[model samples]
Target: MVVDVVKRCFRVFKKANESTGKILGNMIKVQELRRLWGICHMDWVTGLPPGSDKSYNACLVIVDRFSKTQIFFPCCKDDTAMDTAPLIWNRVVSWTGIFTNLISERDPTFN
Candidate 1:
């Protein structure tokens, strides 16, 4: 019964023909589209240095979609937002000349 209900909902959703492309088509520019496509699916991996102190082993990763450029910085676990912010801004902003959107996992230490 649950499966049938789910199937019916899926059919209705598929038939809806939602057209987001039309809405987004005009506003986005070619450069903007290229930038979006460049960074749309980039992944970064950062972790502690080998046997580094747990209190200060966070990593910084910056990815630029347009150029597929990346930079990595290793920081201490005890670093605060105030400390990390400037380091990130300098390295990432200087390299990309634009502030890349950051998607860092919430650090409990920041609390």
Candidate 2:
């Protein structure tokens, strides 16, 4: 019996780029966009294998509308409102200083 020593990489997901035209279509006034960019949008990502407790991890998405820049944060699953609240506040404040608004979607775990 002959064994092959080569290892193959797996394609776990599909990839596609958002077109420039699509980005241009979403544009707003530059100044207002700058103000909006100061705010952050956060959401928790869940849903994984039933037996995999590690799926409890949270994801924080920060978007700057003006620059169209985005940053992501991966946090622990066991984090609570008290814990997460401060963490999110500190992170955004540090990056953008005083932001006028913050947007967050309801996460099932926090309930």
Candidate 3:
């Protein structure tokens, strides 16, 4: 009888926990496009076969979220954050101006 009572209490607690853990009305807020190149989607394509010059084994892909414009910058596979930031700052930022938002794959280069 003691075991049965404990089992019933455990079942009640499990049900209560299950009900309390659920989220009902939370929704993800979508970003709205406000200007050209306002939101930049950035990613790196690594492990690519060496190009004809053999200097580049990776590419930094930057896409404009608003206009769907894409830019590919050839880069080395082992480039660190220092090497990447300057390339984007000089090449991409110079061309498109400053962007408000940047979406990335959270690679080490962005760190």
Q: Which candidate's TM-score is highest? A: 3
Off by over 4 Å in 1: 1-47, 50-56, 107-111
Better of 1 and 2 by TM-score: 2
Query: How displaced is residue 10 in candidate 2, in Å?
Result: 51
Better of 1 and 3 by lDDT: 3
Q: Higher-TM-score candidate among 2 and 3?
A: 3
The Cα RMSD of model 2 versus the native structure comes to 14.2
Off by over 4 Å in 3: 1-30
**Model 2 per-residue lDDT tens digits across residues 1-111:** 123322211222222333446343453333344564565556665443333555445566667655667777666666677877777678767767766555565565467
Error of 3 at 44 (Å): 0.7
Model 2 residue 106 lDDT? 58
Each model's total of backbone clashes: 5, 1, 0
TM-score per prediction, in order, is: 0.44, 0.49, 0.70
**What TM-score quantifies how close candidate 2 is to the native fold?**
0.49
* Global lDDT of model 2: 0.58
Q: How do all the candidates rank in terms of lDDT, highest first? A: 3, 2, 1
What is the alpha-carbon lDDT of model 1 when measured against the actual structure? 0.56
Question: What is candidate 1's CA lDDT for residue 72?
Answer: 68
What is the lDDT, from 0 to 100, of the residue 70 in candidate 2? 78
